[model samples]
Target: MSELRKTPLHDIHQSLGAKMVPFGGWHMPVQYSGILDEHRAVREAAGLFDVSHMGEIDIKGPHALDFVQMVTTNDASRLHAGQAQYSLFCNHNGGIVDDTLAYKISDGHYMLCVNASNTEKDFSWIKRQCTPDFDAEVTNVSSHYAQLAIQGPKAVGILNSLADKDLSSIPHFCFDYANLDGIDAMVSRTGYTGEDGFEIYLSPEKAAQLWQSIMKAGEKDGIKPIGLGARDTLRLEMKYSLYGNDISGETSPLEANLGWVVKFHKSDFIGKEALLGQKETGIKKKLVCLIVDGREIPRPGYEVYLDGRNIGLVTSGTKSPSLGRGVAMAYVENGLDKEGQSLQIMIRNKGVEARVINPPFYKKST
Candidate 1:
């Protein structure tokens, strides 16, 4: 087996007594103090995460915007410089290749933040799509920076202390260059958790220093170093899709309830035809959130049933720390996904009763 990669914060995680595990080919911290503790911290106070394993790809040159627009589902033309939009690259058949965050750095420059597991695939796909006549350069720049996600209700106050400029002014989805703890960084008011937060991208060499600075700055705010365990539960509470689990190459964005990111009126994209057909013909299946009453937590791959007939399978699930109940997301037949619909998840040879509902299962404090 190939050796797993480690992030810049790997040593720090070990020093903190984290439980490390393999994740998407990287040695990642799955928990430190505990998943529940870190989860609660993010909900009530704040938590920090090392997300440097995520991929960063840059597209530049006169046809950058055009090239990006051709590959992604969202309308890139709608984005202003320094603005980012959640988008997806779909195959010709409308199946998602990967969901990405496309950042418009300038008229002819763009950056794509993609899932770690799909990094190579996404980059290769993007490169192959750049026809010989296309005037653009696609660069894989994942190794150049480290990413930190500081998330929670008090996230702003914590980062504001170390930032050279006020972070409050950088609204969600917008990014700007800033000086963080004496290191040049790109600060974006974006997070996977359903909390007000910032995702900081900085030089890999400066990552440890910046991580320590943020930890010290947020000491009084009860900020804790979070791990993948908490990050999964946190994002699950928000119904955010994890690449290999909630969404994948086999799932169409329409089936994943990601139609909002698909713009059909825009010029031809990779999956425009297939998606258009799906829209016109109607999506046969839809993603739905399920709230289970008891402790039998529904888990991924669990079969979902309605009226004693198997309909679909669970994508992601957790015993939510915030809600104190089990929550899950599954793909079921389209008509069975309506809110308040009853369903059952088969766990441990028994069917656990559940109800379909909409999410963000846990909303952030305003």
Candidate 2:
């Protein structure tokens, strides 16, 4: 059997009596206090999360840009140093391999943050594409790096107390690799939640101290430790798709409503031709967000219908605590996906009323 990976803060979670669960080959905390409370904390105050299970790969050398352009569908040349972009890797047929974040740290050095489940596969693919012709190296730095997120409205204040660097200038999706609390670090103003926050990546040995320092500083704002459960609910409320559930190897960016991540202007990428073909011919299926009536939750794998005709299947769903309504995401027949379009979801063998709606059931009042 393969060994299960554990984050540096695993002991801290255990000390707090967090409910640990197996996720993506790693033992991670599902909830520290409770899901609802943790969710509310992040919404109202601040929530700390241990996200060390995520994968990180560093690409360096002169041919970095060339190698990156060949793999992802986005234009790498447009990005400046310290800027990050959400990009997609796709197969030859336009099916998505993963949605990842690419950070151009310097002139010819880039860092790619990927989903935990795709770590090994992504590494192998990068190796296969790389050659002596391109003076670049791809290193899997996931094991060496540990990550923590301090997210909420008061995240800036917390970071200010622990960091000497001027975080006020760090724009969204921009980051800097510097020293924090005497440890090497990279802090980014990026998060899954719509709220402004920072994801701190540092050496595994420094995770415990960094987490405690942030928590201690944010105590005035009631910073509570969070887990995966609330993270899922929070991201879902924003209509952000989760890997493996909402998107997968067989799924395409065109079908997942994630075409924005696939740029055709980039010279040539792994799946550009396939996606361009899809754009011309139109995809058969599309992912849509729906709001269900009544109390029943439309869980994943549930069947969706349109006027008694089978149309789609739910990809992800939840009883939104923030909205007090059951919301769901699904893959449906392309022609049937429209805002305010009515549909039905089969819940426990009973068809429940549902309506396709604009994504993000709850938009934070800006």
Best by lDDT: 1
Model 2 residue 77 CA deviation in Å: 1.2
- Please list the C-alpha lDDT of all candidates, in the order they appear: 0.93, 0.88
Task: For each candidate, give its TM-score against the true structure.
Answer: 0.98, 0.98
Residues 1-366, candidate 2, lDDT per residue (tens digit)? Answer: 587789999999999999999999999999988988998898888899999999998899999999988888788888899899988878888887878899999998998999988988888888787888889999998998899988888887778677778885799989987566676789998998777789988989999998888888899899999999999988998889898888987889989999888878768888888889889999999999999878889999999998889999999999887888899999999988899899999999899999999988778876
lDDT of 1 by residue, 184-249 (tens): 999988999989999988899999999999999999999999999999999999999999998887
Compared with the true structure, the alpha-carbon lDDT of candidate 2 equals: 0.88
> Candidate 1, overall lDDT?
0.93
Give residue 31's error in model 2 in angstroms: 0.4
Candidate 1: which pairs clash?
none
Off by over 4 Å in 2: none
